[model samples]
Structure formats: C-alpha cells, structure tokens
Target: MAVIKAEAYGHGMLRVAESLAPRVDALAVSCLDEAAALREAGHHQPILALQGFKDERDLRAASQLDVAVTVHEDSQLRLLAATRLHRPVRVWLKLDTGMGRLGFAPSRAAELVAALTSDPNVTAVPGLMTHLACADAPERPENAAQLARFEAATRHLPGERSLANSAAILALPDAHADWVRPGIMLYGGSPLADQSAAGLGLRPVMTLSTRLIAIHALAPGEAVGYGATWRSERPTRVGVAAIGYADGYPRHAPNGTPVLVRGQRVPLIGRVSMDMITLDLTDLETVQVGDVVTLWGEGLPVDEVAAAARTISYDLLCRVHDRVQVVTG
Candidate 1:
C-alpha cells in the first residue's frame, strides 16, 4: 500500500492518488477525510485509515465507503462494538510490539483477536500489523527485538500479517509478511541516514522550484537577509528566490545549505524569510533574474536539504504549503 497521509506528504493527495491508483494495490491515509477525498475523486482502490478512526460518524462512513480501519486501542474496539454499520468492515489489529506509541500490548493480542473475530460487524479475519520504530538505522538492536516480539505474539493467531514501513521494506525482508506499507519510499525519500534515494533506486515524485527575482552585487562586508546572518567575502553576487519559509522551505535551514540555480549548485547565504531566500551566486556564471532555482528534487535531493536543516525528509515533504500549485506528471 502507498501511504498517502499528510496530503501524500504534501505532494497533494488527490493528484498523487490519481497518478498512482492504477499502479498500487491499495493506498493508506492517516485519517478518514483523506480516504473520503480519494473516493469522492473516483479512486476505486481499497483505502486503509492508518490512524484508525475518529467517532461513530467516521466509523459508519468508513464502512459505507468500504475503507479499512486500523484498530489499535480498546476505545476504538469498543466504538466498533457499539456502532452498528450497514455492512461488515475490514480491520487491521495493531500490536504494540515495542513502538511505545499506538497499539495494544502484545499480551492482549489474543483477546483483541477474539473480539474482532466474534464481532459480526467485522468482515473476514482481521489483518495483523505493527509499526517499526527504527528500521532506518539497521545497526540498531530495536528492530530485531520488535520483530521477535511481533513473531512470538502472533505465533498462534491466524490472519494475514504486516510489519514493514519504508525502512523495513528495504532493510528487513523477514518482516514483509503479507502486506507492505511504503510511505517515504513512495515519494523517493531516503529513510536511512547513510543511504541516498538514488542508491535505493527510487525516483522523486515532487520537484519544488521557482525563479530568481532579484540580483545584487555586493563588496566584502555587505550583509544579506534578516539579522545580517551572512556577509559577502568578495565582490559577491547574490540571487533572491521567490520561494521561502511560507512556501514550506524550512526557515531553520542555515546559511550554506545548497540550492540549485541554472542547473549548477550554489549555497543559500542567509536566513530564510517568509517570502524569499537568498543564494550565494558567486560561483555560478552570470546568474540572472528569472533563472530557475530548485529547492529540492531532481538534481538536488530533499534528503540533503533536510539533513542541513537538522530534520528528516518526512518533515519537509509533509509541510508544503497549500498556496503552492502542484500538478501530476
């Protein structure tokens, strides 16, 4: 399943879903609203609500929409028991398995399984699933420990199983089980610190770009942007891009983070502001106003910018602003 939550990681859910619907077996969203949007857009693939559900209304809507729900807590289970749906619903019972987030304790797996098995509102056997906490760092012992617990907990249970996210899908084949949920991987973002998306054979789905609107020639000591964070070291040339923090370009990205200009690499030279960012164009030849600048994607990897900003690729991908126009290829 392709994880299309957070507006398909801010690549635009409906657009990405439309592009991917014919290719994937199913799609996963963080909530019912996203799934509903896909259904309303005429997507026919099965949809899974990864965050489970909200209330009785959401539950009923999910059932009528034929969307699967991930039931992780006793409260959600109770809600399922109390609400009468027009038709049987599909479910994935989440196990804690050491994530320390959602999911019931592994010890209670059998009880939940029995409840789900006995509920007339449920259809077929509930699929077994759990999330990996740190599959990206393959050296970490946590991944192995979680897998062992998940295997032991579900040993006697009979149902399809799933335990891999993007990281696990690449690093751990044993946890593939019956279903594999690929999120960041689908967008071509590297989940591991030591790996690159190109090395993993993934293609970027989104490329954020804009054009330079201004150019400045400054002598040494001339400063750039807010707080005068960067000072020209020579007879420096600077290019200002129309893109900024307001467009989901992270403000936390420090001076010297890379930006691609005219297909050549240059360094971002100042603090990112609400409506603009400054790039040190001293090395690029004759960069001009209206020249295209790429923030991330294609020649410039989102992971590289994310690393310079002290964040993960997921954060950058998930926070793209709604004002920006996005279109499918």
Candidate 2:
C-alpha cells in the first residue's frame, strides 16, 4: 500500500492517489474523509484508513465506502460488534509490538483475531500490522524486538500481514510481508537519518520555488528582519525571496540555511518572516530582483533544509501551507 496520508505529505493527496492508483495495490490514508475523497474522485482501488473510524457513523461510512480500517483499540472493537452494516467492513488488527502508541497487546492477537474473524460485521481474517519505532535507525535493537513480537503474534494467523514502513522497507527486508506501507520514500524523502534521498535513488516529487522580490545592500553595522537577530558582519547584499513560513517554509530555520539562487547556493539571513526570507547574496553579485529562488527541492534537498531547521523532512512537507500554489509538471 502507498501511504498518501497528510495530503501525500503535502504533495497533494488526490493527485498523488490518482497517480499511484494504477501502480499500487492499495492506497492508505489517515481518515475516512480521505478515503471518501478518493472514492468520490473515481478511484476504485482499495483504501485503508490507518487511524480507523472515530465513531459508529464513521464506521458505517467506511463500510458503505468500502474503505478498510485498522482496529487497534477495544473501543473500535466494541463499535464493530454493536454496529450492523450493509456489508462487512475490512479491518487490519494493529499490534502494539513496541510502538506504545496505538494497537492492541500482541499477546491478545489470537483472541482479537478470533473475535474479528468471527464477528459478522467484520470481514473474515483481518489483516495484521504493526508500526516500527526505530526502523529509521537500523542499528537500534527495538526494530528487531518489534519484528520479533509481531512475528510471534501473527506467524500463525490466517490474514495478510504488513510490517514495513518506508524505513523498514529499505532496511528490514525480513519485515517486508504481504503489504509494505511506503510513506516518506514515496514522496522522495529519505526515511533513514544517515541516508540522503539521492543515495536511496528517490527523486523528489515536489519542488518549492519562488521569486526574489527585492534586494537590499546592508552596511556592516546594520541588522535586518524581525528581532534584529542577525547583523551584517560585512557589506552584504541581502536578497529577499517571496517565500516564508506562510508558504510552509520553516520559521525556525536559522540564518545560514541553504537556498538556491540563480543556480548558486546562498545563505539565508535574518529571521524567516511570514511572507519572506532574506538570503545572503553577497557572493552572487549578478543576482537581481525576480530571480528564481528554490526553498527546497531540485537543486536543494528538503532533508538538508529540515536538518538545519532541526526538524524531519516529513514535518516540513506536511506543514506547507495551502496558500502556496502547486504547479505539477
């Protein structure tokens, strides 16, 4: 399954779903609305709601929409038992394994699987899935421990099993079961902390580019932007790009963050404001107003920008504001 949740990590969900539908066996989303949106958009492939239904109405809607959902908690199980649907709703029984977030205890896998398998409202033999907490850091012992727990619990079960996210899909070949949930990797972001997307052979699907709207020559003693956090150490030509936190650029991104200007690398200066980020274009003497500036993507990787901002690429991708125009090639 291709995990297109969070608007395909802000690359546009419906478009991503439509694009991946022909290649993937199934598409996974975080909620019923996403699944419904795909179905309403004429996507006929299987859709899985990773978070599952919130209430009986949601469950009923899932059933009616033919969207499968994860069954992780007792409340969801209870809801399933009490509700009568026109058709049986498919379910994936999530095991806690070691994530400690959602999922039932692994020890109860047999009992819960039995319950779901026998329940009239549920499809027979629910799929099994577990999230890995340390798959990104392949050296961590938790990855093996979670896999061991998941294997012990579902090895004898009858349904299809899914255990690999983007990290595990690349690092843990053994964990690649019947279904592999490729999330970040699908959007061309590296899931492994030590690896770059290029090293993983993943091409970025989104490029956030904007124009340099203004340029200012700052004297050595002058400070720029909000808070006056950064002052020119020397005579500096600051190029202001028409992109900032309002466009989903990281506000916390410190000075010296890398941005591409006229195919040359420039250091961002001053605090990232709501609608603009100032860049040190001192070295790029030819840079002028209206020159294209790449925030992240193409010449620059989102992972590198995320690292400078002390965040993950996933956070940056999903935080892109809807106000930013999306131009698909």
Candidate 3:
C-alpha cells in the first residue's frame, strides 16, 4: 500500500495517485473524502481509508465505492454493524500494539475479530494491521515490543497482515508482514534519522522550485525583513525569492537556512515572509532577479530545511499551499 494521505503528503493526491495507481496494488488515504476524490477523478484502484469512517454516511459511501477502512475502535465496529448498505465493506482491523493513537487493545483483538467475522456487513476476514510509533528510531525498544505484541495477538488470525510503514519497511525487515505500506519513502524522504534519501536509495518524487524576483545590495549594518531579525555582517547582495510561508515555506525558518540559487548554495538571511525570503547571494556574483531558486528539492534536501526551521520534512511537504503549481515528471 502506498500511503497517499495528506494529499500524498502534500505532493498532490490526484497527481500521485494517477501515476501510481497501475504500479501499486492499493493507495491509502487519510479519509473517505480523499478516496472519493480519487474515485471521482477516475482512479478505480483500491483505496484504504487509514482513519476509517466518521459516521454511517461515510460508511455507506465506503460500501458503495468498495473503499477499505481501518476499523480500530469498538464504536467503529458498532457503526459498521448498524450501518445498512447494499454490499459488505472491506476493512482492516487495527491492533493497538504499542502505539497509543489508534487500534483496539491486543487483548480485545480476538473479541473484535470474532465480532467482525460474525457481522455480515463487513468482510469476514479483514486484513490485520498496526502502526509503528518508533520505527524511524531503530534502536528504540518500542519497535521490538510492539512487533512482539502484534505477532502474539495476530498469530491465530486468518487474514493478510500489514504492519510496515516506510520506516519499518526500510529498517525492520522482520516487521514487513503480508503487505508493506510505503509513505515518505515513496516521496524520497528518509524514514530513518541517521540516513539520507540518496543513502537509502530513494529519490525525491517532488521537487519544489521557484524563482528569485528581486535583489538588494545591502551596506554593512543594514538589516532585512520582519523585526530586523538579521543584519548584514558585511557588504551583502540580498536576493528575494518569490516564495515564502504563505507559499508553504516555513515562516520560522531561521537565518542561514540553505537555499539553492542558480545551483549555488546561499544562506537565507531574513525572516521568511508572506511571499518572499531574503537570501545572502554574496558568494555568487553572476546571479540576478528571475533566477531559479530551489527551496528544498533538487540540490537541497527538505529535511535539511526542516531541521533549520525546527520542524520535519513531513510538515514542510504537507503544508505546501494549494495555489502552488505541481507537475510530476
């Protein structure tokens, strides 16, 4: 399963899904709405709803569309049992294992399995599933404990089991059960903290690129942008790129954040504003306005930008605004 939720982690749902549909066995989204959108866009492949239905209406839609939902709560099962639909729905029984966020208690798995199997409204043998909370940190004992719990709970269960997220798929080979769900890994983002995308044999699927719109030659002691947070230490040629927080660039990305200007790396020297960022192009003498600048793709890693912004690649990728144009190569 390729996790395409959060607009395929902000890479664009329809775009990614259209390209990946034939290649992937299934595409998973955050909710029924995303799946619906994909279906409306003519993507007829299997789509798994990670959080499942919010109500019977959603349940009804899932039944009609044959969208698979993750049933993690007792209420969800009850909702499924109560919902009247023309066809049985496909479902994944989420085991809590060690992740406190979702899934039934391990002790409650047998009960859920029994109830779900007995219910005629849902598939008798649903896929068994679990989410890894610390798969990115391979050294964490949580991964082992959770895997053990999942294995112990589902040993007797009769269904396909899927427990590997991108991290588990890359790092914990043992955790790759019947199906592996690759999310960040599909977009060339590193699931391991100690690894780079290229190091892991992953390439960025989406490259965010923009152009510089203006330039400024600042004298020593001259400050730039909101709050005058940073001043020129010496003679500086500050160039403003036509991208900013409103463009889904981090507003809090501190000075010295790396941005590629004309394939030359330069330090971001001011607060990222609503529609622009100041770059100290002092090192490059031949650059000018209208030059292309890569915010976090191509030459620079989104993770590096996120680290400087005190955030993560996931946040940066998903937070991209809807107005930005996306073209998949």
Candidate closest to the true structure, highest TM-score: 2
Top lDDT hit: 2
Error of 1 at 323 (Å): 1.8
Q: What is the TM-score of each candidate against the true structure?
A: 0.98, 0.99, 0.98
Worst 10 residues of 2 by lDDT: 149-158
What overall lDDT goes with each candidate model? 0.90, 0.93, 0.89
Task: Look at candidate 1 and give me any clashing residue pairs.
Answer: none
Sort by lDDT, best first: what order? 2, 1, 3
**Residues 131-163, candidate 1, lDDT per residue (tens digit)?**
989899877899999999999899999889989
Please identify model 3 stretches exceeding 4 Å from their true place: none
Query: Candidate 3 lDDT (Cα, whole model)?
Result: 0.89
How does candidate 3 fare on TM-score?
0.98
Per-candidate RMSD, Å: 1.1, 0.7, 1.0
Which segments of candidate 2 are over 4 A away from where they belong? Answer: none
What tens digits encode model 3's per-residue C-alpha lDDT throughout 1-329? Answer: 89999988998888888889889999999999988999899988888999999899899999988899999887887788787888998889998988899888888777788888889998778889999999999889999999999989988978899999999999999999889999999988898988888899888777888998988799999999999999988999999888888889999899898999988899998888998889999989799889999998887888888888898899999999988987756
Pairs of residues at least 3 apart in sequence or in different chains that clash in candidate 3:
none
Using alpha carbons, what is the TM-score of model 2?
0.99
